[model samples]
Target chain A: MTVKINTAEQAASLIDKYDTFLFDCDGVIWVGNELLPSVKETIELLQSKNKKLIFVSNNSTKSRIEYIEKLLKLNINNIKLEQIINSAYSTAIYINEVLKLNKDKKIWVLGQNGITSELQNFGYETLTLDDIKDKELTMENINNLIDLNVGCVVVGLDFQLTYLKLCITLQYLLNKDIPFIATNIDSTFPFKNTKLPGAGSVVEIASFSSNRKPDAICGKPNPGMMDSILSHHKLNKDKTIMVGDRLNTDMKFGSVNDIDTLLVLTGIELESTVSNGHPDVTYYADKLGDLYALGSK
Target chain B: MTVKINTAEQAASLIDKYDTFLFDCDGVIWVGNELLPSVKETIELLQSKNKKLIFVSNNSTKSRIEYIEKLLKLNINNIKLEQIINSAYSTAIYINEVLKLNKDKKIWVLGQNGITSELQNFGYETLTLDDIKDKELTMENINNLIDLNVGCVVVGLDFQLTYLKLCITLQYLLNKDIPFIATNIDSTFPFKNTKLPGAGSVVEIASFSSNRKPDAICGKPNPGMMDSILSHHKLNKDKTIMVGDRLNTDMKFGSVNDIDTLLVLTGIELESTVSNGHPDVTYYADKLGDLYALGSK
Candidate 1:
């Protein structure tokens, strides 16, 4: 399809027709601590038009409250706590739902503080590798431990990845047919000024060694994350547009769920690099300024 | 398709109709160095019927002379050098043909002594990582070096694999977009009674790092190896039956080239594993002794 007009009237008309406007945090509203020039104006315009606004980010390191605080600091105040969707929040909901079905199950988590705290808050017993330091670890020992108590493996990004951890995880999964769940499947994470292997890389290594794929990924691109957001906010899919720069993650969410996508060429994926053009992208813009132009009309 | 069985009388009747009987060396006669019982008898029997027997192996690690020596030790004597079809020979021929078409070209050979020597014999100048050892090495310098005078990259199992070698090769390939040809795709190699990562593993790493698959894999499971065998020996595909045990490699060879395959259970792949069955295997035998049952008619 043709790239829609960059005028404010056309964008406003599209926005008015759709109930939910999902904005990608990075590249759309802000890039690292700096907000885009028209991000606040565009959000205000959408609010005035009686449209629901939600910021969806695949970055699982931050929580909803963290994102809201960041946004409020950028002068985009009046943002509700429920308006942010992060992979970690989706993962927390997934764990809670799974725990509700199986009331007495223990989960071994491989993530940062936010993930462990969230799982514990859901009344599930959570253990880390550090918690079992005294145990003699082998693939067989790990399998026996998992067979006895561990219900499911909950994996997230961990900066201090070790060979011992990978070995133990792979052995346990391989010996006993254990199902694994990951927060996201992003191969790399943008850390400081360079790229580092993310949580997905750990999942990939374990999956490759054991020949078992993750049971479910509770993150972006998967409908689970989007569905969690929509269900939480009582938002309809018919009136939702997913705005992101990456096609595989952002556009995939829109395409899989039949939501409109607004592809902005301001993030990780460059315009010239996206060869497999998605049919879901209803609008294309160079920056958030073009989006504000649509809001004015 | 129903497996067609030609009785001894039928075989004897049609034995004179065919001139050359091209035999696959691996599973037909032996698994590695161990000879199959009645393999000699079968060859003698075929020769008694005035048929020419030629042995073809996709394993390029050994030269035609080496194969002749191995066959001679197994009591199959006086086999001509021209009867052999191997990737090493084919690689030499490919480099010669390419060089004939384009005279001024340098090739980086990432393989063993066999392939390197063969390519050198074909009048093409071959370079290895050792050739660049004297030069100052850095990622930038190595990348710049790869951009100079590189024509083609030929890959095979290199025992002396290093990170520096891999980085340089990948850099040259990514920068220049040079054509890559792999000698084989066997992921694991049977060595000293243990399986080690073979040529396919290195090829996979290079492919993953550069995001470009080999231009052509000049070995097993590809039509190139089979076609070279058929064309060089002047054998028709209809009469040629590839006898091998492995389903993925040997059976895949017959499947792609429309040749019949005889699955012998004495090798790497077992008979029970062939239950799901490939369309390529026209016949199955527990061992060479079972073939004598057809001869008894």
Candidate 2:
């Protein structure tokens, strides 16, 4: 059962227990353009106590810089860009540091600008959907396709995903044993009061056609995303807690990494759902603002 | 072990064994624009013997009429529209017959003209990718969404698939327990001397986002395609044989329905691969034209 940290004393005790708080952005802090109440104050409280704050998100569509801009708009300011880690950034880190992908080899990215920029930032050669589309490559010329320079294929949420893009991605995946990476397979994105297909949809299309599984998924619930953060900062895992609205991605990410989790009901999950699926969660709150109870004590 | 029907006597004996012959088009009879040698004469010979001919294909990009035109071009003439069954038509039949979807209920089709025409033919109010694209539905207008007339979501090979179309299709599939039908989940389609992502790729995108398996796949190896034909023509199952180049879909379709299957080498399968996966195939021929040995006998 999830321990309800409702009283100000209990919340304060829980807050005192952790040295760092890793937050899931969309659900825990804000829902779209509107910021949730008390989020700014709670973060300020944690910062005043010298607790490290990390914003980890699965949204691969935006770069860390863009995410920071959005955060400033929500008034959750004073965070360094280094503390913001999205899936796009995490994927690049995994490729560069873990996979040791050659700087000369290119990644055939089935995603938008964020992934392209991140791969380029890591000094890895990158090819975007536009690169594949601009060439007008089809089956007739596909056989004569000599430039198999791609070392990896990364699939993420692409609004411009096309059949031709998938075909090229499939060819690289099927013809070679190159690494296949997906940022995250989060099925849906809560978009503007409705859900839309996310990166998982694009990954599924390529995986189904190529008949291969992704070698690594650099996102929540996968230790890879947290591994990048944990390795970058020598933080004590025992004193850190992951706060998120979703049990599967956020809470599972925490549990998988041997960190305690706090389930917030302000996102995709409910209280009952957390209890049913993720009994490992250490605490429950209606929203991240409810954690304001912690500072009162 | 696959019994090789090499000699005229062996081929002739096999031909005489079946009263009806269900043919898989792409690999069995033709490879591309070029007709496989002896296929025309062998098919004619089968016709002369008064054997019922049925063409069953998982390719849904083409309508029955268009397929007939292609068949005539290949010189395998005399196949009527009704004798032809493709995944698109089978999906429409499944929706109209098995699902008994109300006439008032519309289907949002993520496919080309083939599926759109078939659904319209069945008198189901239909919306195509073009319809979704024309409206330019986005996340802003998604929540107050008024149009919810869709009762089913049918996915197939769509060259013009867009993100907006996938979003709309996902909405219909997720918001309600609507029938999710896919024409075929064939990973890739042979196109212009190379393979392109097929209907399965499109379906995978929707299925992954919605986190739901298709309620029915109206294509090969599922027996739904064969069921459409069997119920329509009242064909004798015992005396029927399915001939195809691919083992998984065609041979599996035959074996699953208790019909004998003849493996051909002109398309995807080789004599070796067929033996490995489907030893249930009763006979093997190098090509459909190789069945001219039957006529010689």
Candidate 3:
């Protein structure tokens, strides 16, 4: 059964078990732009204990640098570049280190600037949706519109996604030699008061058109994404705990990686959802701010 | 074994076996507005023999009326409205006779005028992509944008497919009570010596975003499409043969429906493709024109 860290003594006692914490940013740290209650004090308490804090997010729309800027803007201080692990940065890392694609070949992107920006920052040239978004697809210009030099196709969330982008992306993906990668396949994302279709919804069009699955879906819930993180960082599995609000992605990420997980109830999950213990989650907390209760005590 | 109707005697002798002929329009009779060699004389020969010639096409873009206009424009004479069996028409028939959707509820279409025209002609109300093509998806207007009167969602080939159409289609499909249908799932269609993404590729976005398979795929090879034709027409299956260029959709349609199949060249397939007899196909011809040889003889 999953333990509930209700009291300040229990929350303080739970902190002693893990030296490093992997935080899922959206729900645990902040909801959209506004910081959640007691997030600052909780983080300060973790830092006072010298616990390592890493923000692991599935935010494919923002690069690590962009994410860091947002974190600092949120007044969450002392965040390092290496402390961020987002699907965009993870996707770039996968393409660079795992695929080891040649530097000469360009990456074709069916996404926004975050993907291209990260890929370019990683020393790889990219051709994004802007290159062909405005062009019309016709028998006359199809051959010219498709870039044969594109070695990899990366699909992420594009606010301005159109049929033209999907058509061009499908043509490239049809070439078996060209690798297709999706940053993440989150079905939907929260916007204001509701949810909208995310990258998973968009990328599946190219996958269906090509009649092929993506070479890599580099995101949470996939053990390979965690493996990529493990290879980059030198951390002991016993000392780390993944902290998040979502059970399927964040908690499952920890369980598959053989790390512990702490689920907070401030985001997508409700109090009633944790009535039964999930195989992935180790403990449930009222909120991330529960750790700050110990500091006040 | 599949017989090759090479000689006039063989072609004439084969015509006596089937009283009804289901013709695939795109490749067998015509190839993109240009009639195939001897299609007129061959069709005329069949008509003179009192053979029923039904134009079965996977054309979801143009309605039956529009298709008839194209046939007349091409000077293909003696065509009857009942003789045309396009996916657009088949889809409407399926929605009307099989699904029995209420006449009051409106159908939301993610396709061209073909789907809407057919549905509207069949005494059903519809709203196409044009209705929401200009509307932007925002948290503020999501409630007002989605029409609750939508009873079914139809997806077909939309040349003007935009992100807005996909986003709206997904919202309706998410409601399980609203039936989801696809006209066909042909991966690619020939366009001026090139094969472009077809309705299958376009409709999959809604299917994936909604995370569910369509309730019905009303097109060739499904057997359900042929069933729709059978339900409407008083033809003997034993006396019917499906003539098409493609083996998968056309021949398979005949096989599953317990009808014989005639393979014709001059479309997508070549001589090498029919070297061995396929279980579904009964005979192979150099072209649909081979049947015209008997007239010349």
Candidate 4:
């Protein structure tokens, strides 16, 4: 059962229950370059109370560092590297810390710099589209271009996706020994009242072509990724409340992980959709700004 | 029960049963540029006996004229346009005769020249990758590149596929009003002791990205394509027999359409696996050229 947050006392009581707050970046705090109304005040209020604020985004198109830069530009500064957990960063962490892949086992990335840059940060070599984007991929030369040294393949949102990248990625995926990891399968991301193809859709090409299932999908509402993030950061699960705009990815992520959830109306879902899909939402607010009722800093 | 054709008497008996032969060109008639042994004699014999032979291939990479040219190079001559039924041609015939689309409703193709050429042959204008291959595709310019005039989207094997083609194809597909057609979903086509991504694999990218299932998949083991070919050519069902190697595609195609099938052992399938997948196969042969035992011309 979800309670409506209309009164300042109700918002304060609910906000007081959690020591840490996990936020879905896109629709919760900001949309694109502009932050939602009262989001600044709400963050400031939480910061004054010394509540741990972490931004978790399913978007693998941008790295956490890039996200930080974007967030800073929006004047939401003082975000530490670990405080932001984008899907690309989650995937990189999963591969490096969890998978503990040997240094010799190179990863072939079929995504944007978000994935490649994050993987590089983990001290792993990756074959990006840039390495062979200009090289001709004929039947006679495809074998030469395919690096057998690649022991893993990472897929994410790649706006610059090409047939050559897919072909190379499929070749790597064909080897069942080489683990396949996808950032997310969100299909379409919300864009200007429309939906654009997401990381999951991009990964489907290689999956369909190779007839291989991904070994790991590092995104919500997957509990594995959430577990990895929580464990990696030593986050107190009981005290951390998931606050987001969407019920499926955000609320469901909290529900699946047994964490409390607050549904904010500033993103994909409206109050009407609240009655459907995920009924496990703990609370619903008209906007993230509603939490500004418990003002401070 | 599948009768094995080994004896000359059995071959002659089988040959006399059918007035028309539906051959899968890749394995039944020829493998690449090389025609199977005794194929020339068998075809000559069938021609002399007034057997109406129709070449059906799931390969949408080439048009009927192109197939005819390739056939001629292999010493197979006297082929008419209507005698060939490639998946691309089947798609064209289905769109023209069955769908009977409006002239103003143009089609955007995400494939090789085979599909575009065939669609053009049927007097339908198409927007191929060539039209926008040079243009820059950004968020700002994508709307201009998408021709909402496209009433249908056709997908097939495209070795020269690009991100622009997929984005444009996805945009056209997102509008549910436009019909989506794929050549086939065979995943991979058999190459020299290996498998390469097929037309089906190529189509999967756009299908995945758009999250829209195709209106029609014009290939084997789909009986729709076969029905179109038969209805167009005015072939007698009772006299026609599908002869091919692969059980899943060629044999299953015949089985689904309630047609007699002859499994040839020159392609993807072996004689052992025939008893597994499609048990409806009427007969099995060591090779297609085994029909040479029924010699005449």
Candidate 5:
């Protein structure tokens, strides 16, 4: 079906007609610790309309608990903990489901405490850099660890990296031919006011060293994450729209899921940049306040 | 020009008449310190015939002094310290003669102690990894250290690899668009009892990371190294033959330098494996003793 809209006013009316609202946190809500001026107002207005709102972010560094605490501190009202979808949480769910289906296997995690803790919580024996710190990092160590015993490798962000860790992980991956699952593909992270290597760097290095690309990426704007978001909200493609600042990740999510994306220029991505990228973004707004103005009419 | 030989005996007779002998150590003399039998006897026989000999290895890890010491310890010949030619020495000479021809620009090395020492001996100011260990390994560090101020990056073997070192070195090389001179492309090194990542691994990673391959390879099979060997020994390609086990590295040396290569099956590469490889071997010998048989005939 065609997107039934004639004006910015019609667009606003159509957005309000949906009971479910999905919002991207980074560009739309705030950039870093600073909150966008109209983000709270937009969320509160959606809540007043009895719309079920979900805050989704591709950033996997922080847990949902951390996000909820930050959101509450920002004075955004009428939001529940369950309404937050994060790459970390989705990654946890994926690991849990895979383990349930497979039944007998250990998972080796190449991430920080959050991923390890989540895997451990799911009753799967999780291995992290800390676990292998005492062991010599070598091909032999990898061969001993990987051979037909371990199930899969889950890659995430590890700030304190070493050649030994990378070498061992790469050798194990290449030798055993194990499947790799990454949390997300954000190449760099905004850390301490500087862009630093993130999980994507590890993924890129591992892929290069092993000569094998990742088997699966569990975060947005991958179809698996979008499917989980849609299924959890009981939303249909025609009834939903993706709203985000970044064109590649957010706009891509909408286009891939067959939902329209409203590109907001106030965040990491600009309208001019997304204009040429696909799937093409449906609309562009200067700010989140402009989106609120649509519903006002 | 046509490698005129009607039989193996004719090939043996031509090898016997050659007065100056050039030998490649890796996949020729020994592979990771397991000596090829008859290598000692062949060298002794060549010495008895008053033939000038040079034991050249593309391995940049050890200096000539170290190679001479190792060869002496292995009981491999009546050879002088100057008879051993290593890639580190060749790299130093290249930096001094080619890269630092202006005699003003300082050369910074991203390699082992041997390379730095060689460069210093050649009257070039060399900065070792120790000089930049404390600096943040970023593109900025590379820019700061290696702008138009630096001449070239001489890549060799470094055991203690850090991301910062790799990042800075790569950034500097890419930023300045400077020529990179690699010692060799051996992917792995046979360590004491296990295999370790070699210079080629670092080169491959840095090349992939920066999206730029090395500008020049100063080591083995390259015409520069082979030419150096030929000039130092005053050898005739028509009469001389390169007897080494590895086809790609050793045999390529002969082809690039217009000499003949006698493939020996006692070391790293097998004849069956390299049948389709470059510089199709002029002769195949199971061991170095087979070459002595040629000389004897």
Candidate 6:
């Protein structure tokens, strides 16, 4: 049964039970640049109680440091750069740490500067759309002369996606030995009030063409995104709670990893949409501000 | 049983059986621009016997007229524009004759000039990437205000594909009432010794993003591409043969529609590839030129 937070006592009991709080940024804390009302105070209250606050986002467009800068700009204080974990950061971690790829193997990225930069920071050579600018480039030209050095294809939210990039990605992925990795398999990226094609949409082209599935999807709900945080901090799953707005990514992520999930109604999901079939989301609140009841008492 | 035509007597007897020949251009007729040697002589010999010949291609990159021009340039005589039925041509026919879409309802095309031109020829209002060139275009602007007048979204081989085109395609397709159409689902467009991302790749992105499947695929192996030819001609199914190199598209198209199929080794398929599980192909030859044995007798 999902515990509904109706009063200060219930809220306080729930909040006090967890030593660490994992927050999904886009919907729970703020939607777009505007901060959800009282979210600042709610987070600060959790911080005052000495609870560990970590912001986990599937938005691979921005790096973790950039997210920290945005958070500080929004007046969200007491947040460290280490406290944020974006998909881009986790993807690099999954590749370098989990996959244990060799330093010599390069990655062909079909994403923005954020993911590319994160991979580069891990001391791996990366190639982007800029690498294949030859006007005379064709399939035959590259067919005989494939850069076999490229061992992985990393796909993320790319606005500058092109046909040539997809061709190159397919060529690499055709070799089953060379892994195909995606930051997230989100069909659409909801921004403001609308949705655009996300990383999954771009990756689907190569996947459909080559008849291959992504070897690893390093994002929320995958559990690989939580690797860095789990290693750095010691937290019990029983006491830890994940708070987010989206049911698929955030709620599923928490449920899949055995952490208690708190669903908020500030974003992608609605109260009417939740049902008995939903994966275990332990609690539901109107907004993060409702958690402020813990400090009120 | 698929008869292996290794001898001239078997080849001649098989060729004499079909009154109407439907050819898949890529593998059987020619690989790329270069026509397979003896294919020209074989086609001329078929013409001398007064057999009706039709060049059916799923390559929507060129119009029927353009295909005729290419054929004439290669010195293949006696083929007219109407004798060539391309996916683009049939897609237009399917929309006009089958769908019977209202003339006022404009179509949003995510393909090349070939399909757009064909739609325009049918007196339908067509919009393409060139139509949405306003510098201020964004997802937000198209969010609340959608072009609801769009009755269908046609996806095909587009070399100049862009992200905005995909966004618009998804926006229209989300309506559910609006139809999603594809020229072909051929994974890759085989061109000049290389395979490039084809129409299927572009459609996969929109299909994945929208969580929708194509309402109609107007290409070979789908039966819609042969609809126009079937409607116009009164040929017997037993006397009509689909000659092509690939077992999947070409042979399947014939088998699905109850027409005889001939598999050639000049393109995608080899003798080793065919098995009992595949759709029935009536005959197999080394190349299109091998059919010349029929005339030699």
C-alpha local distance difference test of each model: 0.67, 0.83, 0.82, 0.82, 0.67, 0.81
Q: What would the per-residue lDDT of candidate 5 be over residues A260-292, giving only the tens digit for each residue?
A: 777777887755665555455776677665656
Candidate 2 per-residue lDDT over residues A104-191, each given as its tens digit = 8989898988888888988888886555444546545665443478889899999887666777788788865689999988888877
Give the winner by DockQ: 2
Model 6: residue A85 alpha-carbon error in angstroms: 1.6
* Evaluation by lDDT, superior candidate among 5 and 6: 6
Residue A96 of model 6 has an lDDT of 88
Tens digits of per-residue lDDT, candidate 2, B47-111, equal 99999998898878777898889989887888899888999999988888878899998888889
- TM-score against native, each model: 0.61, 0.86, 0.84, 0.91, 0.75, 0.86
Clashes of each: 2, 0, 0, 0, 0, 0
lDDT of 4 by residue, A1-297 (tens): 778888878889877899989989888888877889888878888888889998888888765778789878888877888898888888988888788898888899998888888888889998875776656666656666788789899998888877667777877887899999988888877655555677877778778888987888889888657866876777888888999887778898999889999998888787887654456698888888888853432
Model 2's chain B TM-score? 0.89
What lDDT does candidate 1 reach at residue A92?
A: 67
- Give the distance in Å from residue B29's predicted Cα in candidate 4 to where it truly belongs: 2.6
Candidate 1: residue B34 lDDT (0-100)? 81
Off by over 4 Å in 4: A5-13, A31-34, A63-66, A73-75, A132-137, A190-194, A272-279, A294-297, B6-13, B32-34, B63-66, B69-75, B132-137, B191-193, B274-278, B294-297
DockQ scores of all models, one per candidate = 0.05, 0.66, 0.48, 0.56, 0.21, 0.55
The 10-residue segment of model 1 chain A with minimum total lDDT is A138-147
Residue pairs in candidate 2 whose N, alpha carbon or C atoms collide under 3 angstroms: none
Residue-level lDDT of model 4, residues B210-253, one tens digit each, is 87788877898886687677778787777889998887888888
Residue pairs clashing, model 6: none
Model 2 Cα RMSD, Å? 3.7
Better of 1 and 5 by DockQ: 5
| Predicted complex 2: CAPRI docking category | medium
Name the TM-score of candidate 1. 0.61
Clashes of 5: 0
lDDT of 1 by residue, B1-297 (tens): 423334665345434445665566776788667888877776777777667676666566677898889899988876788777677776666555532324467778777777777777767777887776557754335434463676788777675654445555665566545777777776655544333445665565455545567876767777656655665566787777666767787777877888777677777766666655657676666664345546764
